[model samples]
Target: MADDQSLITILEDSREIRDLLTETLQHEGFDTLSFARATEFERNMRGLKPDVCIIDLGLPDRDGLSVVNTVASNSGAAVLIISGRSNTQDKIVGLELGADDYITKPFEIAEVVARVKALLRRKAPKAEATLSKIVRFNGWTADLEQHLLTSDDGKVERLSFAEGQVLRVFLSKPNRLITRDQILDDLSNGESDNFDRTIDVRISRLRAKLHDDPNNPKVIKTIYGAGYIFIAQVG
Candidate 1:
């Protein structure tokens, strides 16, 4: 059960699925708003500012992946993609586009509840002693509390929850080699083959935000067989 009354928005087109999710989440102590179309959700998104968004791929108004990308880039909310497409490519595409988690259709409601809780845990703020609200490195500033990244040129970029989590790991251990396993462990992301690929996609996304060229990356260098190392001086 959710500890607090976190707001959740469901964008599933199926009436049964939407109602089921809304009722289950509400019963679990979460405030939920269900929408059958993407346009309706988008119109109220800015106002609602849900903590988590449960989106389905097949929507009547717009592509769900596009919606996920917009939400991930614009809002601090975590995205969970629920679709009937169980293929690996779909999952990868969803994560690459900034979704935090992907759940295939025919999923257990309990699993949905658990995944929601996990996302909330990741979004929750940690103790001040462990992490500063703002961190700077290589002339870039990261507001961890706000999940905002500001460049030396005064440009600001919003980071998805997954990207922010990866950045936190690297910033916390600069000039040190951090294995993928360690990252997954710190993130508490499930141990699965898909999650391994998830780390790579997240790092790729973070590098883009940092303006780090993937061909010859300077900030985050990938060791052939080992892992990755953050070489920048963080403060």
Candidate 2:
């Protein structure tokens, strides 16, 4: 594809879901950027270059569709709409605005990863989507070397130690599945117990904060007998 190291930006508002998705994306080997507002998203689009963008239509400060339009006008990155809205008109408008795909609410996490791989594959298919050292998911952007997540408005979200660590793992690998065992092990730093339902608890909080439905689930999916997956996109 682009280079097997494409940079993908995640324009989401929730820190908990952000951490989980970032971890999962990094695990499969792709660069990642994360943001929470329109200002930051616009700023980053002007400054940084991303390959694919996953825009969350719901934002506290502004509607994410505006960011998508702005990014499409300014950058050549592939655009993917990640929205809680499942209306046909919304999807048509987003795609007409230049989004490559539209993912509805309450989607499976595995499906998200699959869409990411497909988006990355647009550059060229080699089975891995072949990230070119960076990944652009939505209109939002991230600069791995600088370790900063920014938007088109110039606002920046500096990641913390743990957040960055989690982001790194997800961006490092794209489309690769992650399990709860792996999540708990990584998050616990090796210290876990019988009552260590910390991972599930964190995921639940994240789902709420990210506006993901627990019953239907959008951004993350339970693997039934396995664990969970980050559904960063839908086909």
1-235, model 1: which lDDT tens digit per residue?
A: 6865689999999999999999999999999999999999999997877889999999988999999999988888889999999998999998888888899999999999988988888777655536687999999999986789998999998898778888898988889899877888777646234456678888998999999999999999999788899998778
Give the per-residue lDDT digits (tens) of candidate 2, residues 62-176. Answer: 9888877766544657677888888877876665454656787777776777787765554332354333334443333555434455655666654322233344444544356
Tell how far residue 21 is off in model 2, in angstroms: 1.7
Per-prediction TM-score to the true structure, in the order listed: 0.92, 0.51
By TM-score, the best candidate is 1
The list of candidate 2 runs beyond 4 A from truth reads 1-4, 125-235
Each model's lDDT comes to 0.87, 0.61
Task: Please list the residue runs of candidate 1 whose C-alpha ends up more than 4 Å from where it truly belongs after superposition.
Answer: 125-129, 189-193
**Per-model tally of clashing residue pairs:** 0, 57
User: How many angstroms is residue 13 displaced in model 2 relative to the true structure, after the best TM-score fit?
Assistant: 1.2
Question: How many clashing residue pairs, candidate 1?
Answer: 0
